[model samples]
Target chain A: MSVTSASPSHDRPHWLALDRLGVLITLILLSSFLLPFALFRANRILLGDGLPLLASMQPVAASVLLLALAFGVGAALLRLPALIKLAAGFGVLTILFIAMGLSAETLMPADNNYARVSPAAGFWVLVFGLALLVTDALTRLRLGPWTRIGILLGVCGAFWALLWSGLWNELSILKEYANRAPAFWNEARTHLLLAFGSVAIAAIVGIPLGILCYRVRPVRAALLNILNIVQTIPSIALFGLLIAPLAWVAANVPGAKASGISGIGVAPAVVALFAYSLLPIVSNTVVGLLGVSAPAVDAARGMGMTWLQRLVQVELPLAFPVILTGIRIVLVQNIGLTTIAALIGGGGFGVFVFQGIGQTAMDLVLLGAVPTVVLAFAAAVVLDAFVELTSRGGRRA
Target chain B: MKPGLLLRVFALALLIVLLVAPQAFRDFFALFVRPTQPPIYTQGNLLDITLSHLMIVAIAIGLSTMVAVSLAILVTRPFGAEFLPLSRAIANVGQTFPPVAVLALAVPMLGFGTAPTLVALFLYGLLPIFENTLTGLTTLPEDVMEASRGVGMTGWQRLTQVELPLALPIILAGIRLSTVIALATATIGSTVAARTLGEVIIAGLTTGNTAFVLQGGLIVGVLAVLIYDSLSALEKWLARRTGRLTRADA
Candidate 1:
């Protein structure tokens, strides 16, 4: 963990040599094999009857061994610290992966086809990979022309991988013991996608309102108040509330269904998530717009610009940072709430939460909630980078 | 009075348009509030929306103002300059955290009640208030602060007598923010099964009943706009009053 720190310790403890590029190579090699197995189960496997991860766990186990051996040999032959670090990292990560694969957990107590290997193996692999990646990225960090942007991108990439790939993968993971893990993973993935979609929708609607409110007091007050009320509504209830309008539309509308063929997935999920994101966008937009300053406005107006022109040309550019901050909040919030969307068949991570609650399966709960938490954190970090980038852009302008 | 009344009318018109527009969703509207069912938007529902809206607004604004004011006090002192930006950023982050996350995290400890919703509302309302409080407090004439200190006023004395009076206008703006945020967030109480205005809106949305959704959403929107406009008016009034008082006292 210290290896990933921005300011590394001078006397780098050999145990946590973060800059050990050699370790990254090894870690990746071990992960390449293990992850394929897990990913295969997620994307390719058909969970019909009793099925182990493979007819024999021979491939992953063998690949892990081979990966570890290759890294160690490559490290010594080259006499390069980077190579050595990669080799060692790979060996350790592979051992971890193989050990986890061997101890795969049962996904469902009652079902047969719904079982698979434990997903924790992939999660740890991702973590190991990320640790190496972050460390390497940090070592290469330097002040230059695109330094801030580079740093921001690196941070965002790490965050995206952690959220979108790691914790998120756990929710819809592949299993060796059975397909239950994959089943659970699918439900979570659906939720994540929908939740992300919901946030996306919110951004579409809220950001504009936010910007509008900044320049127009009457409008801003109205929007802020509406969003404020929306913000106070609890998650479960919001989803519940969203049902009414959508149901009404679905049932009454001539040809339109609520979500699509499913008539449930996107419509209700998007509405609930959208309602939740309103405040962040509206609040942020108003603040960001206001931050554009009176003089900037005066100057623009003095330049004989129209109100619309001043807003688009001056206010929006200045207000971009604050707006990004809001968007970041909206994104993070949507990630968490998307979990609750499953209750309505909107599908996503909430399937695990609700299903686990019903079956009293803590493993299923972990399968669902863990990914959401990670995704939320990852989302937050990425949003922050975007916010900073926008802010810097604003400053430069 | 005339313009306020006119705005109120316009707001009501907007509400009616939204609510009645969902006659388009007639079939979906029945799930929550059946045609045979007693009207959900009776005096009780409106009153309910109003009451919940007020309670949340009160709590959020009350708590946020306290926090912002106290923090403003601490950070506006002689040695507190460097901490100002940092404190503001932390406040911003607090506001940035989704109210849903706050509610989710609060659920375990608070166990699905107004308590969690209240806490969420308060935290979510923190940023604007905190920033405005700092802006209002700090932007006062430097001479005023120095004059109070020069004339042998203690820190507390100067704060209560001079600084706070000057900052009150800006602080009111923060309070306005808290009120607006709290009003909307109170709707989230439905997640915990806390029967509030959100109950109506959520009920409407879940079943695809646009009327119920429209009805509930309309009520919320109207209530929010009215209350916020009032707070804003109050802020303007306070700013003017303090402006006069500051000049007269000078």
Candidate 2:
């Protein structure tokens, strides 16, 4: 198929192309048409009955979505330019988001506080499919790093505007948010604190340890083995294991309790996260430093630069990108681990997740889960760009 | 005789003792629990919970391997080459989504218990296997591939006999990674009411039973390390067998 496509065949019919994008678009259409678009519940916690696309919203809104779907299918099948294909993908997505909100508004009985509406399987599948299409188009276009970040910001801003405009107020997740807005922000803060605070501390401790490991062969092997073993422990188990020791400290150790040190909360959570974080940072540092070119180091030595000077001015600078990559990994991993921190009363997004699970409130769970995902995804992208930029700059230097 | 084999045997022995006879370790665990509280997790047998946990990980890893390996193969093939970028993007992005969050999200659609947990583990495990398999298959030596073709091997024959065998070590590394991850993640399945070793940890957490938590954590940690080591050894062996690893590599 690629051979055929690569061949000089401009005269070939466009519809016969049937590229991979077409297959995804077809799946999007099939799912949107066949599966439930929205689910309507009597209350926040009850299981909702599925609603088809047409039945999910007003006729006009449904038709508008259908039109966008048709356009998406057209974009997929036709030999459109990459930019146009991208626009069609985004157009479908934007319409889908709006229609989801509209569906919730339509499905909810006016003045019925108990009524709840949420996006069902079909809605998620569409979002996923369209997102893939948009991504594929972007890849084909070969957008630069900054432009990709700008697009990310744009998409984020669009979602923010949608949220701010009260478009999705009737959606179950939004409704869950409205009730616990303050708590939501509070948990978000704690979540960020757990994830970022640990990474910050780990970097401070890990870099030097990594340097030491790089310098000392026996220590390198022993330290890495220990960290590897630590890494294998499940986050929950680690969190659980920390409880007793920290509690002991809080109780028996002077000023520990007063200093906010405890077994089950932020202290243990941060400690566990920090422990989990060290392996990546330390290993990355070692790798990055080792990766510094031998010629460069010899040149630095020839120039009469001291050992520390060579490390700071030569090796560290060269290794900065790989180190940043490690930091990126740790940051993302910590963010996810922070969710599990909620189990131990560390107070993060997982608070809502566990509470929702306990109460059987799916939307409440989403309130916790969605932001965690979005945050991890954003961090990954931003840090990936940083890594790429630095590596490129390193090459030039 | 080898250190890797010795470590594996030790871990396996310890794991079996812990699972089959909690009474043997009761005194040790009692140090952690208060005098009034039970040291052992008495709600379910340790062996049963461990078995179920292994079952969940096995099932999830098995399903994910099939799906991810197939997808990797598809995208690498000539007919499905167009999907390479898209599949890569999906795998990369999917991994950034946390396992715990994925498990929670699965609950809304699949409801409580093993089903949601299975779905979450399956999704969570896909990236490592897919990415590794993709790397392995694509990075095979060009000469070897040409040689296979030179021998008049059909596409299917080349893939099955030549490509897969040469790529087995790297692919095994991916599955090993996926399996290790699934083991850890499956413990979280208890939060969604799935039967797994997390039950012990959760029970301990809720009831303030440090012994139970330690018991669960110890078992999980031990199991993870053992499996990781064993798989790594297998990967190395495969690499050696395939001549991918020379004496210098060893």
Candidate 3:
């Protein structure tokens, strides 16, 4: 804490005050949207029955009250140790989750199992506020990457426990889940395959393209222009364009359909995802290879290494980090883009989102959207770690 | 003044004429391209739809540039330096959230229209501009910054007159990327009834009309390339202008 706080007087330490934190908490408390949050039928969120805050949810009110008081005190102190701030942020998140669980239990009349409660726009704003608070505190903590990963694992474990223990059985999103629990895994599997398959294909195609761009100057401009043009074609249109050609191939060719190359479904989804993944991967590959120093290559040649040996033993290792960075972008991006697969019956978490929108079910949308985000984030984190590990190995060598 | 710039101008003018009078394309499209299927997307005024699309993209990019550039400036400042990681995490979240998911979630609240699309586009646009701003400010030449300080310029003056002008090219590059991306993504807005070019594309998809899909795709693709080229020129013009200033100073 002193490390950060001990700024030179001339540098001007930015003050952390009670009123600033109070404003966030106050807004959460005072907002009308939070005051009369929605109570929905088990089936839908669009048809909301408003429930007044203090009257309908005593536990939630108390929790928020206690959180505000604690935050107010912390803010009044002006500065605190990093660990303490992190703990406070964690406590705020804990209170939010517990309040959500408690509201699920107490708010709905026990007699009617079909009744559900959905947090209103104000509740979402409060969630956003708490997230900002937590992010600020976590940055203050300055935890190492491994420790951050550990914290994420802990959070995930706790969340899983909450779900498995059925404490959130009454939550509207979980109700949506209860109906499609079996199919959810299938969709998840499809989403993963589509994302990863595209990455694999893109790396196979794009790395060579990048290398070609590096080696052949004349090929670079035309190839890049084509890829750029392809990149700008919106995914929806790209998907639509693929339909006709793919349908023709599937209809005319003897074995195309059997090979999963149909107009609609996983085939076209994977193709579109592959196209989207190419630009980043190819560009990165070019940048990484071009970035390798001439001296390093010369040294390898002087050592009597063959061109292949020089590339494998020197250039590739040096280029690995940048290449990995490109792969990371493509991987994360493909995870998000694969959600569109469900639009064409390719099947992913987007099925839930589109269906939910059709039914005006917010929880179902969350059910799909939340996992897709988590998957993308997790893929990014893992890829980043892998890149770091590989680069560290290169440095050691 | 460059031939490339002149060509871009001519191309843009032609595009405007085509969008405003797509009947201009209809006869030409029929003559040059073999329409495998009849285009059913000719009913709506393509100009109005294109303008609406551009308007939505403009609003989203404008809002994002303001917020993202401000946040970038803030986090790069001495007082707000610690918030850098938090800002990055927020931007990453914005990127990671699928626009479709945002649209689906927002439709219930905002109804089926541009509101949800705007929200999605704004969120999607944030990361590129934010990252670019951060890179531009942080990567300013250290000696140049010291020279500004040694010359006794205040922080605000140094930032506005020196740092920002030097960083303008990179920042513009980010904005260019964001704009192009937003233009492409805005087509999806039609799915939620935001009255976009994506309507034509979606209509084609549902009816399997290849001609309609081609028409929509061609317009959007051409628009992206033209905007991209124009922005690149602007970036180059800024760089050349700054280059002259630096040379004069030397």
Which one is best on TM-score?
Answer: 2
Interface-residue RMSD per candidate?
Answer: 7.7, 0.9, 2.0
- True interface contacts reproduced, per candidate: 0.15, 0.80, 0.56
Instruction: TM-score each candidate.
Output: 0.56, 0.96, 0.89
Point out the worst 10-residue segment of candidate 1 chain A by lDDT.
A39-48
Name the runs in model 1 displaced over 4 angstroms. A1-188, A195-263, A271-326, A329-333, A336-343, A350-377, A390-397, B1-61, B78-86, B193-195, B199-219, B243-250
Model 1: CAPRI class: incorrect
Better model by lDDT, 1 or 3? 3
Model 3 lDDT tens row, A1-397: 2234323324334444333443544565446444554454544654776665444467646568456645734542445554555566566666666666666677677777567776666556656666666666666666555666777778788789878888777778887788889999999999999999989999999998888887898887778767888988888888777887888899999999888889889888988999989888888888888888898888999999998898778988899899999999989888887877787778989888877766767788888988998888777767766787788887787
Error of 2 at A116 (Å): 0.2
* Candidate No. with top DockQ: 2
What lDDT score belongs to each candidate, Candidate 1 first? 0.59, 0.89, 0.76
Model 2 CA deviation exceeding 4 Å by range: A1-16, B1-7, B245-250
Clashing pairs in 2: none
Give TM-score values for chain A, per-prediction: 0.60, 0.95, 0.87
